[model samples]
Target: MLIPKLLWPLLEYEISTSSVESIEAIINTFTRKWLGFPPCQRDVAMYCRKAKLRLPLISIVEEYKCRKARLMTMLEDSDETAVRLFQSHLTINRKWKVCKAVEQEKKALK
Candidate 1:
C-alpha cells in the first residue's frame, strides 16, 4: 500500500546499511501501527477486523485481486503476445507475491 511505498526508500537504505535490527524495528513499528497489533501477537480474526476498519468501503484489495486475476488470465491466453509486449516489463509473478504478502499481513493482524 501507500505506507509501504512511502517506506520503500527507507527500507532500501536500511538494506544498504545491512542493519538487520533497524530493518526489523521498522517492520515491527509499521506492523504495530498499521495492523493494530504487534507482529508476535497477530491472528487472522484481528487482521480481518483491522482490514475491514482500515480499508474503504469500496475495498482496493478486492479490486487488486480482480485485476490481477484478469491480467494473469490474459497473459496465459496470449503468452506470445504478452512476451512480445512486455519483454522485460512483465512482473506478474512479483505482483502475485506482493498480493499474497498483503493478504498474509491482513490475516496476521492483532
Candidate 2:
C-alpha cells in the first residue's frame, strides 16, 4: 500500500549515494514526526518490523537498493548491446554507487 503510493516511479533512474542518503534523512524525519517520536529518536522504532510495536515505516535506502539491484540484474542480462554497455559504465569504473551497494549486500548475504 505504502510503496506504490509513495515510491511508484523511483526505479525509473539510478540515483547517487548522496541523493539516496539525503532522501533517507528526510524519510527518517517524516517517519519520526508521523510516529510521534522525538527528534533524537533512533530509527529502529520506525523500521523494526520484528518489534512488539511496529511502525509502518520504510527505509528509502533499502527500497532504492532493492530497485537498483533489480535494475542492475535486468541490465546485466539484457539482450540489447546499448543497455549492457551503459550498465558497464566503463569510464566510471564499471561500478556505480548502487552497484557497489548491491555487491556489498550480496557479500553480506553470503
Candidate 2, poorest ten consecutive residues by summed lDDT? 89-98
> Which of the numbered candidates is closest to the native, going by highest lDDT?
2
The residue-by-residue lDDT of candidate 1 on 1-108, one tens digit each, is 654453445322312222433454565466567857655754333336456555332222333444444444455457497454642233434324433544465588
Q: Where does model 1 exceed 4 Å of error?
A: 1-29, 33-40, 49-69, 79-110
User: lDDT by residue for model 2 over 11-99, one digit each (tens)?
Assistant: 66444646766777887787678768998788877788999987666787678667767777678789999998776552232334656
Each model's lDDT comes to 0.44, 0.69
The segments of candidate 2 whose C-alpha lies over 4 angstroms from its true place after superposition are 1-10, 89-96, 101-110
Candidate 2 to truth, TM = 0.70
Q: Which candidate is the best by TM-score?
A: 2
